[model samples]
Target: MPIPATAPARNTKSDTDPDALSVLNHVFGLPGFRGAQEEIVRHVTGGGNCLVLMPTGGGKSLCYQLPSLLRKGCGIVVSPLIALMRDQVAGLLEAGVKAAVLNSTLSYEEASAVEARLLAGDLDLLYVAPERLLTPRCLNLLGRADVALFAIDEAHCVSQWGHDFRPEYIGLSVIAERFPDVPRIALTAPADDLTRKEIVDRLGLNNAPSFVASFDRPNIRYEIVDKQNAQSQLKAFIAERHAGDAGIVYCLSRAKVEDTAAALNKSGVEALPYHAGLDAGTRARNQDRFINEDGIVIVATVAFGMGIDKPDVRFVAHLDLPKSIEAYYQETGRAGRDGKPSSAWMAYGLSDIVQQRRMIDESTGAEAFKRVSIGKLDALVSLAETANCRRSRLLGYFGETPAAAKCGNCDNCLSPPLVRDGKVAAQKLLSCAYRTGQRFGAMHLIDILVGRLTERVTQFRHDKLSVFGIGADLNEKQWRGVIRQLVAMGHLAPDSEAFGALKLTETARGVLKGETEVMLREQVAGARIRSVRTKSRRGDIAPQIAGSGGAANPGLVGALRAWRSGVARTRGVPAYVVLHDATIDGIATSRPTTLAGLRNIPGIGDKKLEHYGDELIALVKAAG
Candidate 1:
């Protein structure tokens, strides 16, 4: 493995040039851009403002980074997360690019050194927190630097209604006024119409051309399980699908995070808890361990982390319902970023819906805001309980329609459940809600169904009603399903403030009186059966056309992947970023015998071909 000499410096005067392609190869080692990346980069590099909404792991960074390098002067990127900034800087430095980040995590001396680099024009990219950018010193530095572009990563944070809103991001429009000549690019992974509108208005990107890549991550499998012995179910999932793979388990509360992590650790899994309540050093250490160690699982709350760049996470399991579909998508998107097969499993119940809604209602927001939040929560509930394809429902929320009926990825597609005429069951459940004055949640409703003469039921004297014991035909689990389905179907709404009490909506009257028939898919009976012997643990599944490694030469491809894994493990970086799967496949198929042959691969640009061509050719020849 010989290291090639550094190539001569290239001109950075124009957006389109041989030199720009060379730098693209050198820094990121990709021959061509993916999806809308090339168009977005050209737009930004040609002195144009743009807004880009790409899915996670969809190469959003390259859109800004490549353009920043191709343009004249340094690019100032305002990122919300300090960890994300550090990760980006580390990657750039490893690529032999001059990049630095100024944030709270850095010492004064360190920040001053970066500022010195900026002033000396020795840096190509500098990441700053929006809060820090508002300071007079920072503003002065920006004014003096020959800034060519300003980029706002995670631009969705500018919206107050967004899941990860940052107040400082609201003032980021000041960058436009401060550097009118510098093109501004605002980028976010997941944002709906509301968030997008807010980003445009709040960040003042009204004039910027917008680039929205498809929000579909087709490789990911989506599953939502009912919260019945959720811990055991989670254990079974991990043991079967993600054995010995890096993953994340998200919980709603800090206590749950600690408990879940402890349980997994006790069960022989390398798991750790992460939350804001943990000491800063401990949090940092845990994050580093998860990134550096293979097969490590980090159980964390919403406060723990976001925008994590780890590519090989095989699964993301949510112990509770997330606040909204956007948050759910972002969190789930963290898994399988390397275009590998991954699963997003969520275990949620009626309690999760009520609890999430209660938290939103208790927030210091107006009635209208609370109503909007509840609507979003209801949407999430619908997504969780829907019998339709989970991937289609999820992608549809992001305004994408799937090209197929069954994605063959999610639990629904893997094992389609049976549909039953739930009209009678729905009527019984709605009657209980109305007869009980909509004062109790699914538990009490279930009790009424099974004829459980609990003290509360007797105290309310509602057990004597015709609807109380009449539903005893259905068991407890069946009754619970009915209640969940009813809520999902919009006949009943959960009263968050009243601790998940069931409230009858106008639609409930029609169903309760038998005017409208409600049909629901019956829950799979005896679906929890599992053998003591675990299935063979495979690495994350790849797309069907591209198997695990997606290579043409089985032997050489395996050797190359082993080499890549070793290199990535040693450097503590993701394997895909080093050389993407498409590049590897090209190497295996073309069997590039010369540098020129390697340079012709679609994703292997001049810089990468020059640097790695000889070693790859040698390895292929040795295998031959």
Candidate 2:
């Protein structure tokens, strides 16, 4: 049951071509296409335009990268972020492809050199920002070059409804009109139906074939926890599960980013803060440190991690709610890029919704755009509060039906709670919001629910309200759930600019007047249990290592990992780069007992194979 040699390569041939598989093998180093990649590549390479909606790690790049290599002319890649374009170029170069990027970060001489290459047709792929591509001089150069294809990376940015919309991207349809014969492919990791339609309409992909890949990252475990002792919970979660893995901790604000990074560092995590507020050099340095060092934690605002190419991030923990599920999915998709198990942990409360909505309200977009943004935020709130499988809820949002009723990797699937009849509770909560003049946040509402005669309750002289102190049986946590679920159910709207004051929407009138029944569940704590189990399962994968002198065998690698783990525990260095998995796998497969044989391993250069040659050989012999 072994996979075919060409299984990973994309096939971009017409029905008449018989050597399609052969072409795939020669160019991409793999056998066949993955998912919709083959069809996408074939469509684009065969002079057909396409709109490809694939998940973050769903081989979207290969759909265009392979075609770029096979076609007769250079591919024009329009990307929003310069850093992301540079990373893609670097990856292509490492794979022995001719690629160049033109961005503002480059000096005049450097930019001119890339342009020279483009004009000479020396590059197979050229990455350019949309703003630069639309320039008169750049367009003139592109016209002269033998352009085979045009690709819009992060195509969702073109849509005003998308989480990361950019006005510049909407102008890219000009490329299509200018280069009518060259095939154009629009690619994005996360986009919904509205955004997808907007992308097609704005980018003029009217007659293009569209491919929508299933937006499910099964390898990522999702969990949402209540925001109580959030810092301690996050620390414990990181320490226990991701002890030696690269991860991101996303905060809502720059100050929170700095504070969280400091807290993680104080607790022995090698962490850094990144935000637009930081100087360019400091931000770049911190990003580099996170990428190069394993187990390094980066606490940053949403400004960070747009085009990061790190492949082994183990987790993404959000300290605040993202503006939309599309943003959340793209952010969490950064983890487990190497097809390993990873976690997406989030801690959110009513305050996050208020803050995010306030920002949205303050934006300069049209009213229709604001409405769409708010709707997306409400959908995300539903996902967070769902008592059903989190994975199913998330996938369902992107138009995929889940086969299983419960995904064993999510918080609700692992630890489900009993749903009590909260019809009366909902009515009470809604009535409290209405009777209290809809001007308070969750804390004040909780005080009224639990009959806490605090100063605020007495100062407002609102203890005399009929609904006040009526539901003292429910605890503060349960009351908060009622309020959150109300917000998620659209019965209550937390006014953004009024400092998160709770307001009873028109929908609340039904519940208040006993015309509608609201169902609610008490929020459950300790949803991290399933994620912990997944981490333990991943840890059970044995490491493969062998001796240096060809005197030992495959099992020796696992022993070396054990030894390395002990050493790393003492020295606090990650075990992966101390001895890469590839190095260990080679040693185990070859049983390289000699220093020369060890040097023959792919990742073990002479310096490393020589320095640790004796020690590894001895360990292998001891194991035997």
Candidate 3:
């Protein structure tokens, strides 16, 4: 009943070479290729080029990793983050692959040694920073070595349209010109149609087949709460649903990151702040602690992103809005990497829209760039405001054709909001903007419409307008919601040159002329009841930790997790790298007591089985 050592990584490999299966079972211990992984791996291994858009935790690494081992020469992985490189190389080494990293962190001796290894064909994989990889010395060294393929990790950064664009990634196009024969692959977690085109054009992967895995992470429940008291809402959500679980909290500014981390810590949540303002050492320490230590939350800005392989992150909470949907997806996709249920919860409000628009318009970017940014922001805002299924809209933005209108996972799908016809309200708001000469922001315009005769209103003689007191039926908050929804729906826009003035778009003319109808959802009060099926219901995540999950883990999983934690701590690797939660799930459920039983479990390759087989067997026997 044991899985064959030659079992193919995926059954779709009906025509795949058997050696891929051998390397999969003997080296990686995975059952088979997931999604389009088999096709991608085979294509690249057989000397083809590809651009892969797989979601985070969808095993993007394996697409390149398997081929790296199977091909005749070393694989060159151009990555942008140090933490990412470190995690990949470490995980590969644990799997018995000859992996190394060449970064600024290494001393001359270490660099020389790794260079020697590469020249000697001793490494199966080498991760290099984009800046370092593009250097004359590094490129020359690579030109001399036999490279089986070029794996461009985080390939979305090459796109100028993306949120995480890097200038150095542009130079990566040289790979095609230099190693025309070697296979090349570019992969990223999130990219819209435009960004995809940018990656394709900039990276010179024109002829490469694109293997886009489903962007849907069904395990992740998307919750975008109307931002009222975001800090309190965030605290309550954490306390109620994800207490003691490892999570990431993203804010929009350095000051906010520090403040939020301070607040969370003051409230007894173990939290740390991460921003570019922090010293390199502090950032490194905080990041390391957040990764190695369990149940710690890291409040970070965009600077701390692009994943560090801490797979058990249960939630990704956004205290402020990201710039675009690509940014949002990239940040939230960091959660639930291990295929367990997770939450991508966000708190946004009217001010977030104002702030984002101001940033885009006030930026020094070209007119085209600003237009694209505004369009992307508007799409994100639409996602936030829609009464329909959030998942469908989100996936739709990425050009994913939704199979169903409702995903049964997002807050809206679970608890559909009450809708009200806001046609009259929209007319009044747009008329007020027009009557006010479209020269004021939401606050001043609201004051004019609601008839709160302030000094500015009196000075502008806005009290004399016929639209005055027309919206008195709605409170300031309700009116703000209306305006927010209007902006989100593209009925109005911020006047960038006027420094926080309101502007009516052409769409506003339709509303003002009664040519278009409007409906808006009642604003969400707070976080909805946390849903999405995951391991927490069983209290199985690191059993000893308090408030970590529900009741108790039925004996064996707890003991093995405790053991795995100790091993990971001693070995200084992320706990999942030692034995993934899935592998532990397999062992605890199967209760394997023999070497064959252990070997039969996925994630236990020859190297891992040899290293931990006896101990696992003994543990299973004692538990029995």
- Which has the greatest TM-score? 3
TM-score of each: 0.89, 0.85, 0.92
lDDT of 2 by residue, 486-507 (tens): 8889898878657779898898
Distance from true position, residue 617, model 2, in Å?
15
lDDT rank order: 3, 1, 2
Candidate 1 off by > 4 Å? 1-19, 458-462, 526-624
Model 2: ten consecutive residues of lowest lDDT? 1-10
Could you tally the backbone clashes for each prediction? 2, 14, 4
**All candidates in order of TM-score, best leading:** 3, 1, 2
Task: Please give the lDDT score for candidate 1.
Answer: 0.79
What do the candidate models score in CA lDDT, each in turn? 0.79, 0.77, 0.84
Residue 488 in model 2: lDDT: 84
